[model samples]
Target: MPPSPVVPCHSPVPDPSLYEPINTLKPVVPDVWIADGPVVRMAMPCGLSMPFTTRMTIVRLRDGGLWCHSPIAPDDALFAAIDALGPVRDLVSPNQLHYAHIAAWKRRYPHAVARASPGVSERAAAQDIEARFDAAFDDAAPSPWPGEIDPLLFRGSRAFGEVVFFHRASATLVLADLIENFEKEKLTRGMRAVARLGGVLDPDGKAPLDMRMTFTDRGAARDCLRQLLAWKPQRVLLAHGRWYERDGVEQLQRAFRWLE
Candidate 1:
Protein backbone atom coordinates (compact mmCIF):
# COMPACT_ATOMS: atom_id res chain seq x y z
CA MET A 1 0.00 0.00 0.00
CA PRO A 2 1.09 3.55 -0.64
CA PRO A 3 1.73 5.91 2.24
CA SER A 4 -1.11 8.05 3.55
CA PRO A 5 -1.64 11.34 1.73
CA VAL A 6 -1.58 13.40 4.93
CA VAL A 7 -0.81 13.33 8.60
CA PRO A 8 -3.07 14.99 11.17
CA CYS A 9 -1.96 18.45 12.19
CA HIS A 10 -3.58 21.50 13.80
CA SER A 11 -1.24 24.41 13.26
CA PRO A 12 -2.78 27.29 11.33
CA VAL A 13 -1.01 29.03 8.49
CA PRO A 14 -1.16 32.72 7.70
CA ASP A 15 -2.28 32.06 4.13
CA PRO A 16 -4.47 29.16 3.18
CA SER A 17 -4.38 30.39 -0.39
CA LEU A 18 -0.71 29.39 -0.36
CA TYR A 19 -1.72 25.75 -0.03
CA GLU A 20 -2.68 25.04 3.52
CA PRO A 21 -2.07 21.89 5.55
CA ILE A 22 1.54 22.50 4.79
CA ASN A 23 4.47 20.17 5.53
CA THR A 24 2.59 16.94 5.02
CA LEU A 25 3.06 14.44 2.23
CA LYS A 26 0.28 14.36 -0.34
CA PRO A 27 0.34 11.35 -2.59
CA VAL A 28 0.53 12.05 -6.28
CA VAL A 29 0.65 8.43 -7.26
CA PRO A 30 1.82 5.16 -5.85
CA ASP A 31 5.27 5.72 -4.31
CA VAL A 32 5.40 9.33 -5.44
CA TRP A 33 4.30 12.37 -3.43
CA ILE A 34 4.61 16.10 -2.86
CA ALA A 35 4.71 18.29 0.23
CA ASP A 36 3.65 21.91 0.06
CA GLY A 37 5.54 24.24 2.37
CA PRO A 38 5.20 27.74 3.70
CA VAL A 39 6.02 30.78 1.65
CA VAL A 40 9.67 31.84 1.60
CA ARG A 41 10.80 35.37 1.00
CA MET A 42 13.25 35.59 -1.89
CA ALA A 43 15.41 38.62 -2.38
CA MET A 44 15.16 40.01 -5.86
CA PRO A 45 17.62 41.99 -7.94
CA CYS A 46 15.41 45.07 -7.64
CA GLY A 47 16.18 45.50 -3.91
CA LEU A 48 12.92 44.00 -2.75
CA SER A 49 11.87 40.64 -1.33
CA MET A 50 9.39 38.50 -3.26
CA PRO A 51 7.27 35.87 -1.58
CA PHE A 52 7.34 32.42 -3.19
CA THR A 53 5.23 29.45 -2.27
CA THR A 54 7.54 26.47 -1.71
CA ARG A 55 6.99 22.80 -2.50
CA MET A 56 9.03 19.60 -2.53
CA THR A 57 8.79 16.26 -4.26
CA ILE A 58 9.49 12.88 -2.66
CA VAL A 59 9.94 9.58 -4.44
CA ARG A 60 10.26 6.23 -2.71
CA LEU A 61 12.69 4.20 -4.77
CA ARG A 62 12.16 0.53 -5.37
CA ASP A 63 14.88 -0.33 -2.91
CA GLY A 64 13.02 1.58 -0.19
CA GLY A 65 15.41 4.53 -0.09
CA LEU A 66 13.66 7.87 -0.47
CA TRP A 67 14.68 10.45 -3.07
CA CYS A 68 13.88 13.97 -1.91
CA HIS A 69 13.89 16.86 -4.39
CA SER A 70 14.19 20.48 -3.42
CA PRO A 71 13.24 19.77 0.17
CA ILE A 72 11.31 22.56 1.86
CA ALA A 73 12.06 23.94 5.32
CA PRO A 74 12.25 21.13 7.83
CA ASP A 75 9.50 20.70 10.41
CA ASP A 76 9.36 18.18 13.26
CA ALA A 77 5.97 16.71 12.38
CA LEU A 78 6.88 16.62 8.71
CA PHE A 79 10.11 14.83 9.47
CA ALA A 80 8.30 12.29 11.58
CA ALA A 81 5.83 11.63 8.79
CA ILE A 82 8.72 11.21 6.34
CA ASP A 83 10.44 8.85 8.74
CA ALA A 84 7.44 6.58 8.53
CA LEU A 85 7.78 6.41 4.73
CA GLY A 86 11.34 5.07 4.54
CA PRO A 87 14.99 5.95 4.92
CA VAL A 88 16.06 9.09 3.13
CA ARG A 89 19.00 8.27 0.87
CA ASP A 90 19.14 11.20 -1.52
CA LEU A 91 18.64 14.90 -0.92
CA VAL A 92 18.54 16.61 -4.30
CA SER A 93 19.05 20.29 -5.03
CA PRO A 94 17.68 20.76 -8.53
CA ASN A 95 19.03 24.22 -9.22
CA GLN A 96 21.33 26.88 -7.85
CA LEU A 97 18.52 28.85 -6.18
CA HIS A 98 16.77 25.93 -4.47
CA TYR A 99 19.30 24.42 -2.08
CA ALA A 100 18.72 26.51 0.98
CA HIS A 101 17.44 23.72 3.22
CA ILE A 102 19.76 20.88 2.20
CA ALA A 103 22.14 21.57 5.03
CA ALA A 104 19.39 21.27 7.57
CA TRP A 105 18.04 18.07 6.04
CA LYS A 106 21.56 16.64 5.87
CA ARG A 107 22.08 17.31 9.56
CA ARG A 108 18.99 15.25 10.24
CA TYR A 109 19.82 12.45 7.80
CA PRO A 110 23.58 12.16 7.99
CA HIS A 111 23.70 9.10 5.76
CA ALA A 112 21.81 10.68 2.88
CA VAL A 113 23.97 12.11 0.11
CA ALA A 114 23.11 15.67 -0.87
CA ARG A 115 23.33 16.02 -4.64
CA ALA A 116 23.45 19.36 -6.44
CA SER A 117 23.31 20.91 -9.86
CA PRO A 118 26.17 22.93 -11.37
CA GLY A 119 27.11 26.28 -9.86
CA VAL A 120 25.31 25.59 -6.58
CA SER A 121 28.52 25.62 -4.55
CA GLU A 122 29.55 29.01 -5.90
CA ARG A 123 26.08 30.43 -5.41
CA ALA A 124 25.99 29.23 -1.80
CA ALA A 125 29.40 30.71 -1.14
CA ALA A 126 28.46 34.04 -2.71
CA GLN A 127 25.25 34.19 -0.72
CA ASP A 128 27.01 33.12 2.50
CA ILE A 129 24.63 30.20 2.87
CA GLU A 130 26.04 26.93 4.17
CA ALA A 131 25.10 24.17 1.72
CA ARG A 132 27.25 21.06 1.58
CA PHE A 133 26.72 18.55 -1.18
CA ASP A 134 28.21 15.08 -1.25
CA ALA A 135 27.71 14.63 -4.99
CA ALA A 136 27.08 16.61 -8.18
CA PHE A 137 24.75 15.79 -11.06
CA ASP A 138 26.13 15.60 -14.57
CA ASP A 139 25.14 14.29 -18.01
CA ALA A 140 24.83 10.74 -16.75
CA ALA A 141 22.43 9.45 -14.14
CA PRO A 142 24.02 8.77 -10.78
CA SER A 143 24.07 5.63 -8.71
CA PRO A 144 21.26 4.19 -6.47
CA TRP A 145 18.31 5.35 -8.53
CA PRO A 146 19.43 5.27 -12.15
CA GLY A 147 17.18 2.56 -13.53
CA GLU A 148 14.13 3.80 -11.73
CA ILE A 149 14.50 7.55 -12.31
CA ASP A 150 15.93 9.45 -15.23
CA PRO A 151 18.10 12.49 -14.52
CA LEU A 152 18.91 15.29 -16.94
CA LEU A 153 21.42 18.08 -16.59
CA PHE A 154 19.90 21.07 -18.32
CA ARG A 155 22.71 23.13 -19.72
CA GLY A 156 23.08 26.31 -21.82
CA SER A 157 23.04 28.98 -19.16
CA ARG A 158 26.53 29.71 -17.91
CA ALA A 159 25.18 31.16 -14.69
CA PHE A 160 22.11 28.95 -14.19
CA GLY A 161 21.53 25.24 -14.61
CA GLU A 162 19.06 22.65 -13.33
CA VAL A 163 19.09 18.91 -12.86
CA VAL A 164 15.63 17.70 -13.79
CA PHE A 165 14.25 14.33 -12.78
CA PHE A 166 11.65 11.90 -14.07
CA HIS A 167 10.18 9.09 -12.02
CA ARG A 168 9.47 6.32 -14.50
CA ALA A 169 7.00 4.34 -12.44
CA SER A 170 4.92 7.35 -11.64
CA ALA A 171 5.38 9.14 -14.96
CA THR A 172 6.04 12.35 -13.12
CA LEU A 173 8.45 15.16 -13.94
CA VAL A 174 10.10 17.09 -11.12
CA LEU A 175 11.41 20.56 -11.83
CA ALA A 176 12.72 23.60 -9.97
CA ASP A 177 12.47 27.12 -11.34
CA LEU A 178 12.13 26.03 -14.95
CA ILE A 179 8.46 26.98 -14.85
CA GLU A 180 6.55 28.70 -12.07
CA ASN A 181 2.75 29.02 -11.98
CA PHE A 182 1.62 31.22 -9.14
CA GLU A 183 -2.12 31.31 -8.65
CA LYS A 184 -3.35 34.88 -8.83
CA GLU A 185 -5.73 34.56 -5.89
CA LYS A 186 -3.01 33.19 -3.64
CA LEU A 187 -0.71 36.09 -4.24
CA THR A 188 -0.95 39.60 -2.81
CA ARG A 189 -1.92 42.31 -5.27
CA GLY A 190 1.65 43.55 -5.60
CA MET A 191 3.02 40.03 -5.98
CA ARG A 192 0.35 39.25 -8.55
CA ALA A 193 1.48 42.22 -10.56
CA VAL A 194 5.09 41.23 -10.15
CA ALA A 195 4.34 37.67 -11.13
CA ARG A 196 2.49 38.85 -14.19
CA LEU A 197 5.46 40.97 -15.17
CA GLY A 198 7.77 38.02 -14.55
CA GLY A 199 5.61 35.79 -16.81
CA VAL A 200 4.97 33.33 -13.99
CA LEU A 201 1.33 33.83 -13.16
CA ASP A 202 -0.98 30.86 -13.56
CA PRO A 203 -2.64 29.74 -16.84
CA ASP A 204 0.29 31.27 -18.69
CA GLY A 205 3.33 30.67 -16.49
CA LYS A 206 6.65 30.26 -18.18
CA ALA A 207 10.25 30.66 -17.17
CA PRO A 208 10.74 34.00 -15.46
CA LEU A 209 11.63 36.73 -17.91
CA ASP A 210 14.87 37.43 -16.07
CA MET A 211 15.73 33.77 -15.99
CA ARG A 212 14.99 33.52 -19.70
CA MET A 213 17.48 36.32 -20.29
CA THR A 214 20.23 34.19 -18.72
CA PHE A 215 19.79 31.51 -21.35
CA THR A 216 22.06 33.07 -23.93
CA ASP A 217 22.27 29.73 -25.62
CA ARG A 218 18.67 28.86 -26.31
CA GLY A 219 19.73 25.94 -28.51
CA ALA A 220 21.21 24.06 -25.58
CA ALA A 221 18.13 24.76 -23.49
CA ARG A 222 15.94 23.65 -26.37
CA ASP A 223 17.84 20.39 -26.56
CA CYS A 224 17.23 19.75 -22.89
CA LEU A 225 13.63 20.71 -23.34
CA ARG A 226 13.36 18.11 -26.06
CA GLN A 227 14.48 15.40 -23.71
CA LEU A 228 12.00 16.54 -21.10
CA LEU A 229 9.22 16.44 -23.68
CA ALA A 230 10.21 12.96 -24.79
CA TRP A 231 9.78 11.70 -21.25
CA LYS A 232 6.00 11.96 -21.76
CA PRO A 233 5.31 12.59 -18.13
CA GLN A 234 1.73 12.47 -16.91
CA ARG A 235 2.28 14.76 -13.93
CA VAL A 236 4.62 17.69 -13.48
CA LEU A 237 5.75 18.90 -10.05
CA LEU A 238 7.16 22.35 -9.48
CA ALA A 239 9.00 23.84 -6.50
CA HIS A 240 6.93 26.99 -6.61
CA GLY A 241 3.32 27.76 -7.51
CA ARG A 242 0.71 25.36 -8.82
CA TRP A 243 1.74 21.94 -10.16
CA TYR A 244 0.16 20.07 -13.05
CA GLU A 245 -1.35 16.76 -12.02
CA ARG A 246 -2.21 15.87 -15.60
CA ASP A 247 -1.43 16.86 -19.18
CA GLY A 248 2.20 17.13 -18.22
CA VAL A 249 3.46 17.09 -21.79
CA GLU A 250 1.07 19.78 -22.90
CA GLN A 251 2.02 21.90 -19.92
CA LEU A 252 5.72 21.48 -20.68
CA GLN A 253 5.18 22.45 -24.27
CA ARG A 254 3.06 25.40 -23.26
CA ALA A 255 5.55 26.62 -20.69
CA PHE A 256 8.50 26.33 -23.07
CA ARG A 257 6.82 27.73 -26.12
CA TRP A 258 8.93 30.80 -25.51
CA LEU A 259 11.95 28.70 -26.41
CA GLU A 260 10.72 28.22 -29.95
Candidate 2:
Protein backbone atom coordinates (compact mmCIF):
# COMPACT_ATOMS: atom_id res chain seq x y z
CA MET A 1 0.00 0.00 0.00
CA PRO A 2 1.13 3.56 -0.70
CA PRO A 3 2.22 5.56 2.36
CA SER A 4 -0.31 8.10 3.61
CA PRO A 5 0.79 11.69 3.81
CA VAL A 6 1.76 13.13 7.24
CA VAL A 7 -0.55 15.94 8.16
CA PRO A 8 1.28 18.83 9.81
CA CYS A 9 -0.26 20.32 12.92
CA HIS A 10 0.41 23.96 13.76
CA SER A 11 -0.31 23.47 17.43
CA PRO A 12 1.41 22.93 20.75
CA VAL A 13 1.95 19.21 20.98
CA PRO A 14 4.61 18.52 23.60
CA ASP A 15 7.13 15.89 22.50
CA PRO A 16 7.44 14.03 25.79
CA SER A 17 11.13 13.22 25.63
CA LEU A 18 12.40 16.70 24.74
CA TYR A 19 9.94 18.77 26.78
CA GLU A 20 10.69 19.74 30.37
CA PRO A 21 7.58 20.96 32.25
CA ILE A 22 9.55 23.25 34.56
CA ASN A 23 12.77 25.20 34.17
CA THR A 24 14.92 22.79 36.13
CA LEU A 25 18.32 23.99 35.04
CA LYS A 26 18.35 27.58 36.24
CA PRO A 27 17.40 29.34 39.47
CA VAL A 28 14.49 31.76 39.40
CA VAL A 29 15.67 35.29 38.71
CA PRO A 30 15.49 37.69 41.66
CA ASP A 31 12.74 40.26 41.73
CA VAL A 32 13.23 43.60 40.02
CA TRP A 33 11.43 46.70 41.22
CA ILE A 34 9.43 48.38 38.47
CA ALA A 35 7.62 51.72 38.41
CA ASP A 36 4.66 50.74 40.61
CA GLY A 37 5.92 47.43 42.08
CA PRO A 38 8.30 44.48 41.83
CA VAL A 39 8.32 41.63 39.31
CA VAL A 40 9.89 38.19 39.38
CA ARG A 41 11.14 36.24 36.34
CA MET A 42 10.87 32.50 35.90
CA ALA A 43 11.97 30.12 33.15
CA MET A 44 10.98 26.71 31.76
CA PRO A 45 11.92 24.25 29.05
CA CYS A 46 9.18 24.57 26.42
CA GLY A 47 8.29 23.94 22.74
CA LEU A 48 6.11 21.22 21.29
CA SER A 49 7.42 20.26 17.84
CA MET A 50 10.85 21.70 18.60
CA PRO A 51 12.73 22.43 21.82
CA PHE A 52 13.54 25.79 23.39
CA THR A 53 13.46 27.59 26.74
CA THR A 54 10.98 30.30 27.65
CA ARG A 55 10.31 32.69 30.53
CA MET A 56 7.39 34.20 32.48
CA THR A 57 6.95 37.36 34.54
CA ILE A 58 5.16 37.75 37.88
CA VAL A 59 4.16 41.09 39.33
CA ARG A 60 2.42 41.89 42.61
CA LEU A 61 -0.75 43.90 42.23
CA ARG A 62 -2.01 46.62 44.59
CA ASP A 63 -4.26 44.00 46.19
CA GLY A 64 -1.16 41.96 47.13
CA GLY A 65 -1.95 39.18 44.72
CA LEU A 66 0.50 38.03 42.05
CA TRP A 67 -0.16 38.77 38.36
CA CYS A 68 1.62 36.24 36.17
CA HIS A 69 2.26 36.92 32.48
CA SER A 70 3.03 34.27 29.82
CA PRO A 71 3.34 31.57 32.45
CA ILE A 72 5.95 28.81 32.21
CA ALA A 73 5.36 25.11 32.79
CA PRO A 74 5.07 24.09 36.45
CA ASP A 75 6.90 21.65 38.70
CA ASP A 76 7.13 21.16 42.47
CA ALA A 77 10.22 23.31 42.93
CA LEU A 78 8.86 26.15 40.80
CA PHE A 79 5.51 26.01 42.59
CA ALA A 80 7.16 26.34 46.03
CA ALA A 81 9.17 29.29 44.84
CA ILE A 82 6.11 31.01 43.41
CA ASP A 83 4.17 30.38 46.64
CA ALA A 84 6.91 32.08 48.65
CA LEU A 85 6.28 35.32 46.78
CA GLY A 86 2.54 35.62 47.47
CA PRO A 87 -0.83 34.25 46.44
CA VAL A 88 -1.15 33.97 42.70
CA ARG A 89 -4.29 35.90 41.81
CA ASP A 90 -3.81 36.52 38.12
CA LEU A 91 -2.51 34.38 35.22
CA VAL A 92 -2.03 35.67 31.68
CA SER A 93 -1.15 34.56 28.15
CA PRO A 94 0.46 37.47 26.34
CA ASN A 95 -0.06 36.09 22.81
CA GLN A 96 -2.09 33.42 21.03
CA LEU A 97 0.94 31.12 20.81
CA HIS A 98 1.85 31.54 24.48
CA TYR A 99 -1.10 29.87 26.20
CA ALA A 100 0.42 26.40 26.42
CA HIS A 101 1.40 26.78 30.05
CA ILE A 102 -1.50 28.95 31.24
CA ALA A 103 -3.60 25.89 31.91
CA ALA A 104 -0.87 24.42 34.08
CA TRP A 105 -0.65 27.58 36.16
CA LYS A 106 -4.43 27.75 36.43
CA ARG A 107 -4.50 24.21 37.72
CA ARG A 108 -2.04 25.16 40.41
CA TYR A 109 -3.58 28.53 41.25
CA PRO A 110 -7.33 27.98 40.98
CA HIS A 111 -7.96 31.30 42.72
CA ALA A 112 -6.04 33.11 40.04
CA VAL A 113 -8.00 34.97 37.36
CA ALA A 114 -6.51 34.03 33.98
CA ARG A 115 -6.36 36.50 31.09
CA ALA A 116 -5.62 35.32 27.56
CA SER A 117 -4.20 37.35 24.74
CA PRO A 118 -6.37 38.33 21.75
CA GLY A 119 -7.48 35.27 19.74
CA VAL A 120 -5.86 32.95 22.28
CA SER A 121 -9.15 31.42 23.34
CA GLU A 122 -9.74 30.24 19.80
CA ARG A 123 -6.24 28.87 19.56
CA ALA A 124 -6.68 27.07 22.88
CA ALA A 125 -9.97 25.59 21.69
CA ALA A 126 -8.26 23.97 18.72
CA GLN A 127 -5.25 22.66 20.64
CA ASP A 128 -5.12 20.07 23.41
CA ILE A 129 -4.28 22.82 25.92
CA GLU A 130 -6.93 23.01 28.66
CA ALA A 131 -7.26 26.78 28.94
CA ARG A 132 -10.28 28.90 29.75
CA PHE A 133 -9.48 32.53 29.20
CA ASP A 134 -11.20 34.64 31.89
CA ALA A 135 -10.71 37.68 29.65
CA ALA A 136 -8.60 38.98 26.79
CA PHE A 137 -6.18 41.90 26.60
CA ASP A 138 -6.20 44.58 23.93
CA ASP A 139 -3.87 47.42 22.99
CA ALA A 140 -4.84 49.29 26.13
CA ALA A 141 -3.53 48.29 29.51
CA PRO A 142 -5.93 46.38 31.74
CA SER A 143 -7.11 47.41 35.25
CA PRO A 144 -5.35 44.76 37.28
CA TRP A 145 -2.06 46.59 36.99
CA PRO A 146 -3.27 49.86 35.58
CA GLY A 147 -1.04 52.89 34.93
CA GLU A 148 2.06 50.77 35.43
CA ILE A 149 2.03 48.22 32.62
CA ASP A 150 1.22 49.43 29.12
CA PRO A 151 0.06 46.84 26.57
CA LEU A 152 0.39 47.24 22.80
CA LEU A 153 -1.55 44.89 20.54
CA PHE A 154 -0.05 44.29 17.10
CA ARG A 155 -2.94 43.38 14.85
CA GLY A 156 -3.39 42.42 11.16
CA SER A 157 -1.87 39.00 11.54
CA ARG A 158 -3.62 35.64 11.77
CA ALA A 159 -0.43 33.67 12.30
CA PHE A 160 0.28 34.84 15.86
CA GLY A 161 -0.64 38.35 16.93
CA GLU A 162 1.05 39.50 20.16
CA VAL A 163 0.39 42.09 22.85
CA VAL A 164 3.63 43.66 24.02
CA PHE A 165 3.97 45.22 27.50
CA PHE A 166 6.04 48.04 28.91
CA HIS A 167 6.57 48.27 32.66
CA ARG A 168 6.96 51.90 33.68
CA ALA A 169 8.87 51.38 36.89
CA SER A 170 11.84 49.44 35.62
CA ALA A 171 11.78 50.90 32.14
CA THR A 172 11.54 47.35 30.85
CA LEU A 173 9.60 46.15 27.82
CA VAL A 174 8.24 42.60 27.80
CA LEU A 175 7.51 40.58 24.68
CA ALA A 176 6.39 37.15 23.51
CA ASP A 177 7.09 35.73 20.01
CA LEU A 178 7.72 39.23 18.64
CA ILE A 179 11.46 39.10 19.27
CA GLU A 180 13.82 36.19 19.73
CA ASN A 181 17.51 36.69 20.63
CA PHE A 182 19.31 33.38 20.57
CA GLU A 183 23.07 33.06 20.92
CA LYS A 184 24.76 30.97 18.27
CA GLU A 185 26.23 28.61 20.83
CA LYS A 186 22.92 27.93 22.56
CA LEU A 187 20.92 26.45 19.69
CA THR A 188 21.08 22.87 18.54
CA ARG A 189 22.53 22.10 15.11
CA GLY A 190 19.08 21.92 13.52
CA MET A 191 17.80 25.03 15.33
CA ARG A 192 20.92 26.86 14.24
CA ALA A 193 19.95 26.27 10.62
CA VAL A 194 16.37 27.34 11.31
CA ALA A 195 17.48 30.47 13.13
CA ARG A 196 19.91 31.33 10.40
CA LEU A 197 17.35 30.91 7.65
CA GLY A 198 14.81 32.91 9.69
CA GLY A 199 17.38 35.68 10.40
CA VAL A 200 16.94 35.56 14.19
CA LEU A 201 20.19 34.09 15.40
CA ASP A 202 22.83 35.67 17.62
CA PRO A 203 23.70 39.25 18.65
CA ASP A 204 21.21 40.98 16.37
CA GLY A 205 18.16 38.75 16.72
CA LYS A 206 14.73 40.13 15.88
CA ALA A 207 11.41 38.64 14.89
CA PRO A 208 11.62 35.76 12.44
CA LEU A 209 10.97 36.42 8.76
CA ASP A 210 7.91 34.16 8.78
CA MET A 211 6.33 36.29 11.52
CA ARG A 212 7.35 39.58 9.94
CA MET A 213 5.77 38.59 6.66
CA THR A 214 2.50 37.73 8.40
CA PHE A 215 2.17 41.31 9.63
CA THR A 216 -0.33 42.75 7.19
CA ASP A 217 -0.42 46.25 8.68
CA ARG A 218 3.07 47.58 9.09
CA GLY A 219 1.49 50.97 9.73
CA ALA A 220 -0.21 49.74 12.87
CA ALA A 221 3.00 48.07 13.96
CA ARG A 222 4.92 51.28 13.36
CA ASP A 223 2.49 53.29 15.44
CA CYS A 224 2.68 50.70 18.17
CA LEU A 225 6.47 50.83 18.12
CA ARG A 226 6.31 54.59 18.41
CA GLN A 227 4.11 54.26 21.49
CA LEU A 228 6.57 51.86 23.08
CA LEU A 229 9.51 54.16 22.34
CA ALA A 230 7.84 56.97 24.28
CA TRP A 231 8.24 54.78 27.36
CA LYS A 232 12.07 55.00 26.92
CA PRO A 233 12.77 51.46 27.99
CA GLN A 234 16.18 50.70 29.46
CA ARG A 235 15.84 46.92 29.29
CA VAL A 236 13.81 44.35 27.36
CA LEU A 237 12.55 40.94 28.45
CA LEU A 238 11.75 38.20 25.96
CA ALA A 239 9.96 34.85 26.26
CA HIS A 240 11.86 33.02 23.55
CA GLY A 241 15.51 33.91 24.03
CA ARG A 242 18.02 36.15 25.83
CA TRP A 243 16.79 39.53 27.10
CA TYR A 244 18.38 42.95 26.78
CA GLU A 245 19.66 44.31 30.07
CA ARG A 246 20.57 47.65 28.55
CA ASP A 247 19.97 49.82 25.50
CA GLY A 248 16.37 48.63 25.29
CA VAL A 249 15.21 51.53 23.17
CA GLU A 250 17.96 50.81 20.69
CA GLN A 251 17.03 47.16 20.70
CA LEU A 252 13.41 47.99 19.92
CA GLN A 253 14.48 50.27 17.11
CA ARG A 254 16.60 47.50 15.74
CA ALA A 255 14.02 44.79 16.25
CA PHE A 256 11.51 46.80 14.26
CA ARG A 257 14.03 47.87 11.67
CA TRP A 258 11.87 46.41 8.93
CA LEU A 259 8.99 48.71 9.82
CA GLU A 260 10.60 51.77 8.36
Candidate 1 on 149-184: residue-level lDDT in tens?
998888778678888898999899999999999999
Q: Candidate 2: how large is its RMSD?
A: 11.1
| lDDT, candidate 1, at 63 | 90
User: Which lDDT value does model 1 have at 111?
Assistant: 98
Alpha-carbon lDDT of model 2 = 0.70
Instruction: List, in order, the clash count of every candidate structure.
Output: 0, 2
TM-score, one value per model:
0.92, 0.79
